[model samples]
Target: MIRFEQVSKSYSGGVQALQKISFHIQPGEMAFLTGHSGAGKSTLLKLISIMERPSAGHVFINGHDLSKVNRKQIPFVRRDIGMIFQNHRLLRDNTIFDNVALPLVIEGYGLKAIRKRVETALDKVGLLDKARYYPNMLSGGEQQRVGIARAVVNTPPILLADEPTGNLDPKLSLEIMRLFEDFNSVGTSVLIATHDLGLIARMKYRTLTLTRGRMVQDGLEASGANGVES
Candidate 1:
């Protein structure tokens, strides 16, 4: 569902975040992105979400070319993508129900529809009982799950998570990853950007490794292959 062809992203003053990165993630596929601190994983996700335009080459979601998308068209394109961040990014003052309902509300869904969708998303994340609770009342894992629910409330076809498990313990991390697996099983394409090598090794999914802003490895661990490195 995501294709990047010779994509490069350079900021002002000659700071390059990505250098000619090319990769395609098929629909319903689940993959992990791993790299060092400055390897451009975040930048790559931003480009896909159209938060930043490419300096060169192209980024395509489904069959839509992002470079050709105008500013007015960006929101429409984003409706198909759900984004999760390391920090939950919830509103401190909002209840869980309100938080999860934000996307649908923004999309102008009716009150009845928003309530149903928000509850369904909360149920998926095992947070339905906490719907009336504020984010501050939840544990770290629960808070992150709330973030997940908020992201998926719109039922977007593609999900992109950036360091999603960074703040959780290994057990909580596994729980969170399993939730992503569950979503992937139902045909939502999942791309997770994480630095957890041990977790990646255990999960045995296809992994894309980056180094110095370039893709260095793309391999499936189940086959014991190190994949191509450039």
Candidate 2:
């Protein structure tokens, strides 16, 4: 679960990306962050991942207060949270299996465990046969699937995706969403940052909309209950 109380983020160059934002995401719940460019969706994700710190209040993940979390413990916290990126961020030199196996390998998981987890992750993403293929050898959709596999390989309790389907077609985007839903059904908390309002409109997940770096609305679905203004 994620809880942000009066959180604010101001970059070094004096640009304030988030302004007193506050919200709570329940454990095992799935939500989408909706906003236009510079609306602070990515900033929110970064705060939860400890990629950046808040200029103001607190950001709590599960029971950990991000502001009070130690530098040495950031890694341990991150291991329980998975992240997916817009570009997949796969290493061009590594095969799909290697890429998916990176997290476990980094965690010092033995070869056997890595192999089994990697295979299972790839199978879930429908990319088992492409395991031996390199990033350049797969289509955009396939590459993203590999990224998904990499994120879920560790069975993290929370999943944060930033524009994960930004590069894929609508059909592929739907497929990826369904995959996230499946993961959520198994108890993983999912927070997806996406600007695709149409794609989000079709689903019933809670929708958080932001504008001018502040939360404007938190709706239960496509309902008119949530909207913040510029």
Encode model 2's per-residue lDDT on 135-181: one tens digit a residue. Answer: 99999999988988999999999999999989889999999999999
Collision pairs in model 1: none
**Per-candidate count of clashing residue pairs (backbone under 3 Å):** 0, 3
| Candidate 1 lDDT tens digits, 7-98 | 99999999889999999999999999988778899999999999999999999999889999999999988888989999989999999999
Candidate 1 whole-model C-alpha lDDT, 0 to 1: 0.91
Off by over 4 Å in 2: 222-230
Q: Candidate 1 regions off by >4 Å? A: 222-230
